[model samples]
Target: MSHDNSAENPKNIDRANNAVSWDNSIRLFLQQAGSSSPTPGGGSVAAIVAALGASMTSMVGNLSQGDKFAAIHERIAEIIGRMNRLTGEYEQLLHADISSFNAYLEALKLPKNTEEEKTLRRAALHEAALHAIEVPLRLMESCRDGLAEAASIAEECNKNVISDLGIGVILFEAAAQSALLTVEINLASFKDEERKRSFEQKVSALTQEIGELKIRALEVTRKRIAGDMA
Candidate 1:
């Protein structure tokens, strides 16, 4: 039985162990991000920001529910559920994005000394790059969805925490835009013209939707804020 070099290599062990993830504290995550290591980079950070936004959306929704909001209590509860789920999903995606990019790095290390080796290496790299592209694209889609959900929260959530909703909107918009940028970076390596074109179209639509949702959420949030102030 042959030992798999990719699995048994000391370098591989180091990388697998070193990759930063959601289980780590914010302090640890930020420390890793600031370190020379590149695994916990843009894609992971984007997922984290988006998750925070979703969590905040859930926070506001849960806080707003009571006799004060009895008329729309159920709707607020539904939004709470959705935001909570999105927060969990985004947290998972944070680890996934880090793994995908690391897989690409591993693909780069495949033996390419001979014709057969070169062909295998090329195929592996192509597959890994596609997976890498997929991670950030999913991140964008998740953030876009979170933004839309957060926008809806402004409509019926507690007026007192309207500022929290507003903050969540900004964070969601930041995550969506940053995740989209990360997708654009990876898209360059996705060589399948047809699928790449399809993905790009989805990105365009997602960006437009994110923009509109942010506009509406902020407008509603500010109006309520002003009304409260006056």
Candidate 2:
């Protein structure tokens, strides 16, 4: 879970160009999720969640850039700034996703024919699962934080952009759900029941929290929109 800020460096034009170009990277990431490959699995999805959160943050910022909401420029700018930081963090998560997958795949190669080998393989699996767990946990945290940003924007952002905030809320909710699924899937593969129970409980708590946030965001957005229409 090492975080690298280099990906966001302005001098790294090549990396920035390729990452934001929106060509095959996202499609490939999604494709790999469906593929037999394990590397781009949960971690990649978590990174995507973070990306989506950042994207929504950007959307809110864009909507805030004009006339009526000018008073809130500082606040919107802060949200955008945080999203920028999270974007870099998400890129690092992408690397983490690959590393965790590779660790699991390598662990799978341990010779299970011998008793000692079986023990090694089990250890590897546990380690791999732990790595896998980190990806979603990080994503859950990012999404939750992003939700707070969205809430702020929804409360104070330009009325014209109210729908965009709603969209951000929905996107954050989706990211949260995606991350939760990843956590559950990885936890299911764990060999220790105690560890599994612990992780499951945390995941359940996250699920409930996300559900509550989703409901609140939706209600706020709806009322805001209705008020505007009225």
Candidate 3:
């Protein structure tokens, strides 16, 4: 009998530990999300939503090709590349959010019976809490950036797919808003006031940017669909 040790490799072990793939059915994911499990929670949902938005942006770009669009072909190509990159980033973020939450739970389990233990536990908790906040913060930032790229080509893309770009921007806004809520919830329990305020400022700016981008993108989409931009 041959014994296999490939799974024992450190890199493989790490991958197995941190893996959070969502390549399964949407219904399966939804069922798991709706279950009692705290994971695949709001943060993961936000990340996936952002991924879908990026995918939609890429789809619009792909459908907008032709001699009729020669002038802005380069711009559409650029938007597609950026949206592809954002889609990959959002997939990673989905895993990061779940892992960060799990890390916080592990930190909470750290022993705190003595003064030294309490100090160590507190440090662990603070680090975990910060990681949790950072994951969602990155999601918010990515959504804001993705929305900008998606909005940039909204009016120039194929008229048939204009609505998709609009829907993509809306998804970006929703994801950013959801990520913002996750960050704020974590901040509520966070101990560092100065850091909290800094994060809050970013959240506020992103909130405004996301909302404005959605409105502008959708307006372009509406105009094009209604033949006003023709």
Candidate 4:
């Protein structure tokens, strides 16, 4: 049996480490968007926003994990964990966004000299665009849920971390709003009436949900904060 030495190569090791570091840097990059970089763009930014919301929820739960908050800690922790998983899913969605864009780019390069090829390219572009649109739509939904979860925690979590939960709700709201833009932009390119109508309906529904969640979160946070101040 021939032993493969490629895995042991110093350059390969460095490359592997670099990939890991890059993955980790995504979170940092979104945290500091003012800095220049091509990737971790709007989609990644949305993911980071969702992650921040999840992180804040987690912080509140962790702070309340002791006997004082025993009744709610487990439930809050479960919600936080779900949010964290959603955040990770959003990150994966960002990667999918890149792949979806690349597919569209490839489709654009397809030979237009033949009608069959043209049809194929059009189909490819349509599918790719749909994927692009769906990625953000899903993120919007996830962020909307995060906003709701954050609001729930804000209303009932330990007083000390209520502000953090508010921040989480705000981040999720921003993320949802941002993701909705991507969904709308992609939807504009889709030519199918039925599909367009379906997407539009979904967008409308999500928009309403987001608006309601935002209002509810703000109201809860404001009331909690006001009560604390009083």
The numbered model that scores best in lDDT is 3
lDDT of 3 by residue, 92-166 (tens): 888887677556556666888999999998898788789878888899899999999988887678889888888
Candidate-wise lDDT, in order: 0.77, 0.69, 0.80, 0.71
Q: What tens digits encode model 4's per-residue C-alpha lDDT throughout 19-109?
A: 1122567557645444433344566667767777888877877787778777787787788688768768877776765566556555666
lDDT of 1 by residue, 176-205 (tens): 888887778767756789989998998899
Model 1 weakest 10-residue run by lDDT: 1-10
Error of 2 at 90 (Å): 2.1
Which parts of model 2 are misplaced by more than 4 Å?
A: 1-46, 228-230
As for candidate 4, its clashing pairs are none
Q: What is the lDDT of candidate 4?
A: 0.71
Q: Let me know the TM-score candidate 4 reaches against the reference structure.
A: 0.83
Candidate 4: deviation at residue 189, Å? 2.0
Off by over 4 Å in 4: 1-22, 26-38, 228-230
Better of 2 and 4 by TM-score: 4
- Could you say which candidate leads in TM-score? 3
RMSD vs true structure, all candidates: 5.2, 8.5, 8.2, 9.2
* Model 2 steric clash pairs: none
Who is ahead in lDDT, 3 or 4? 3
Task: In model 4, state the lDDT of residue 124.
Answer: 84
Worst 10 residues of 3 by lDDT: 1-10
